[model samples]
Target: MSLYTTTLLILDPDPYNSIDRLYRRVIQQAMHVTLPTGCLDIFVARPPTRFRETHFVVAQLYKISAELKQLENKEDIDVRVLLEGVGGFDIGDARNRSWEVVAVGKSDSKLLPVFIAEQHSSWFSPALQIIILPMERSIETSSRLPSLPSDEDGSHPPTEEGPHLGEAGLVIDSTDEEGGDLDDEGEEAQYPIVALGGTFDHLHDGHKILLTMAGFLTGESLIIGVTGEALLQNKKYKEYLEPFPQRCAAVLNFLAYIYPALHATTDEINDVYGQSVTIEAIDALVISGETRQGAKLVNQERTRRGFHALKVWEIGVVNGDANDQWAGKLSSTDLRKREFEKGELAKGQGTQQKLE
Candidate 1:
């Protein structure tokens, strides 16, 4: 445990790759590959076939994100953009009306990426990080993080020394040394594009880390997106969590209290130079470390289209109760049994007499 080892990986896909192409990008079919855990995310590819956009195209995403947040009880939905093609408001006006309102806009190239990442993050990873790629050739090709070597012994190596007490018995600086910096940037860095993605089911401690990281890095308002139930239609991972509607509500609850335009915050998401940059106007994105490769590629695509390539910002992973027996992959049948069993076990332990 003296020296810890963790590496960034990039998954390179072959055009002839036989792997289900659906997993390539975020889409409605996510439930297929992903387990039906209420809080997990899976990406899918929208095979390029032109489809007409309607009023509520991307509107569902914001609603979903907000609902998911509410279900978790944290209740803070910050940023979102939709692909409403006609019957509703445009992306620029995403926040003019409440998430409850309908929107309208054509499915632009950028909206899909945002929608996919958030929608999936709400369920798959919980700690959501969304990265949307404008449907333009920003980069020639994309890459992924190198896969890690699982411990053959069936256990993970110590990432670092266990937490240690500090001055006044405090757990001082147990964090990784190589974390993202807060104040490193220039003009180009200020207004850089970003790729945002996630499955933010029960926004927990780890999820907050990701959000904090994104806000710190961009120094501006962020853009968020998620998948739709119509697209998330049939999946495997939906057992022990709230549905999309509830999840999005949780998120919006959190955002209102924190950035409620009336709250007091020292570290506000100011513009590149302290300008007005709130959720209604996003210039950057917040993403999870679990999904850097796909996001990077999308950013590259934007660059090719004469758009600012996104500067990657990271939220260090935070831990949550999902590690408990109650939370896990969703099954069509009985997945909640784990939670029930754990509860029974606790009850039995309480009644057992302790031997002196």
Candidate 2:
């Protein structure tokens, strides 16, 4: 199937109750029309309350993505949630360990064939390949691009033109005047330098949320310690573990897109402490909920070395439905295993066909 490598989805919560239904319908429709395999950038606009309630946004998106796996012919879509634009809020003082709201915006060129709910259509222009949600059992748009068939029937035509920005819309660029100055009163002052460590193997949404939270906290620099080869020898599906360089590059690239305003540094760490124990300048450490105990060990080592204890912040794990084979947490190891299973299934199907 022909797919759009990257697509933008603009969302605005009209009554809050429809958010979940709206998201599911949009995904169901897009699968038929655009086949977004590379990435799905969800841009939420208006209703400043949604910005303040970020935990809801993150949880809802993750829920929808998890449900996508149950759908037939669902592709692996990298779901990214953005909360920056007209009537949107900035990444405020979201340092608490609780699932607080943290706004996000990206700097990317026009994403073609944008999918938006009919109620939130006022946020963008109609000249682009715009697909409205709650679709009339058909793919409807005002763009000059040819009309495509619905998810259930008809031909899937390719869209040639790119996305268009609304006259009053914001692109959330760091260099551009409109998107500039996102940080108010040195938002980084709370934490001059933020630090975090992870294996970052497959670079999934869980990793993105962790990194973004750290990036949002950083005022000066974001220090990421990518696990070295020595530490990853026993990882599950070790063969599928991405090379350290590739993993590091993916982390850096994602940071540039989501929070380009700050300078980020990545280091290869052979041990658990990494630079967090040695770097005296680091103001804070971002960790997942499961590693809260490790934060104490890090601080104890720092205090032993005559260094100040770093203020540690935590982010909750992105969870999938509990099942016998898969735990609740969205893990890279589980992702790798799923990929391996898919490969094995395809191999079995191919062999069966050959025998026939």
Rate residue 351 of model 1 by lDDT. Answer: 77
TM-score of each: 0.33, 0.64
Residue lDDT tens for model 2, 1-356: 33565555555533223345445666555444444455666665542322113434554565566577447355466666655531112222111112111112111112222322331344333323445445222233353322222234222222322111111011111222322112211122347888999999888878877776676567778899999989888888998888889999999988776665668889998887899988898888887756655677778788888888777665656663223332567799987998899899999999999999
Cα shift from native, residue 113, model 2 (Å): 17
Look at candidate 2 and give me any clashing residue pairs: 188-219
lDDT (CA) per prediction: 0.30, 0.57
Model 2, position 197: C-alpha lDDT score: 93
Error of 2 at 162 (Å): 36
Error of 1 at 205 (Å): 1.6
lDDT of 1 at 224: 41
